[model samples]
Target: MGGALVVYESMFGNTRAVAEAVATGMARVAPGDAVDVIEVGTAPALAAVDADLLVIGAPTHAFGLSRPTTRSDAAARTGTGVLSTTIGVREWLEHAGAPAALPADGATPARRGLPAAVFDTRVLRRNLPGHAADAIARRLRQLGLSLVTEPATFTVDGYTGPLLPGELDRARAWGEYLATLLRALPLLPEDAGATGARGRTETPGTGRSAPRTGRPASGTGPSAPGSPR
Candidate 1:
């Protein structure tokens, strides 16, 4: 088994809690695996030679991956300088030109073939049209990470949530499951045969599954345990 890391970004406490749960799950299922959970910006050294599987978490923002509004986050940074950075996070990315060019990394090739997964926290759309979790999943696939497609949806009765009661437990389960996979990295059971495949376990909000910061978009229902992303 290889050492694993669970990295995440959360605005409100909901996504952070989910991240922890996922980390916990990884530890439980793969006791032999080393698991380190870190928040987004404070992520461990991804460039480390010892690093193996790379796990990520984020909220679905405005129908997409919630980023700092930078021009380009994952793609901007070069091996050692700003010229090679993914600067599209908080700034207007359009100026860089959607059809424009991205910085080329002379030190490392694009992370086009890494293993990755995405999880999201969101408010119910009353329909599937606003399902941002799926969007997060899709983005991860585009980045060339092997898709585990374990995207999840968190319940938000209204904006700031009470989490509909059993949210924490559900979060814990997610963590345990992730630990299981990380422990057996590069060789765990495929999503085709287990927990997430055909309703083997009870999830937080929706079955098809589905964080945080500066008060995300508001929800319309009852109060949730935390805020909606």
Candidate 2:
């Protein structure tokens, strides 16, 4: 059986709930697969992440990925009930190191090219603009990991949210889809750069390197959450 590691950061626990649902969904489709879910603060060291797939999730803050400062703000918010430590996902990624690059000489290497996927929890609003999903995707791509799919966004009612109705189901479905897609991806070390493989045709750590302000695009303004990326 293959293994998956799901690491997530949550302030009001909305994102954490989505992470659990996503893991459950993956388990349903890949019954033989082992899934480990950990909060960012308690996450095992990145060097020890030997899972076949790495799935990450975070809540959108300040129209993009939450910085330490933003996380501090979240913790300070009234009624947040944030019992966990203050670490956020951005800090974790900075220390996670780039995913192993495709091995040279067509030989299998320890920690061969890793495949990753990302998702974000956002407030459900009609016109909310920026998102953490794109930021998260860029970071993974910058790390040289194969992205099985574009980043996925799940919605919440508000910042400290009960997820929107059926959003949990949608997240689960996305996870199952990810499991299926990963199962179909070419896994041989030599196949990393092949056409059918994801993200390898491009240079390492250069997937869709779009210039970003870490803010929403022009004419866009923050509204609610889960803005399309």
Clashes of each: 39, 1
Q: Tell me the TM-score of model 2.
A: 0.74
Structural similarity to truth (TM-score) of each candidate: 0.57, 0.74
- Could you give candidate 2's per-residue lDDT for residues 86-170 as a string of tens digits? 6778877777665553342324321434667777877756445677866777766665565555566676776778887777776
Task: Report the lDDT of model 2 for residue 219.
Answer: 18
Per-residue lDDT of candidate 1, residues 80-186 (tens digit) = 32221231111221232322122223133223334444555555455434434455444444333444434555655443344555656666665554444444444
Q: Per-residue error at 97 for model 2, in Å?
A: 4.1
* Model 2, runs deviating above 4 Å: 97-112, 187-229
Lowest lDDT block of 10, candidate 1: 212-221
| Candidate 1 deviant stretches above 4 angstroms | 44-50, 67-113, 182-229
Q: Could you give me the TM-score of model 1 versus the true structure?
A: 0.57
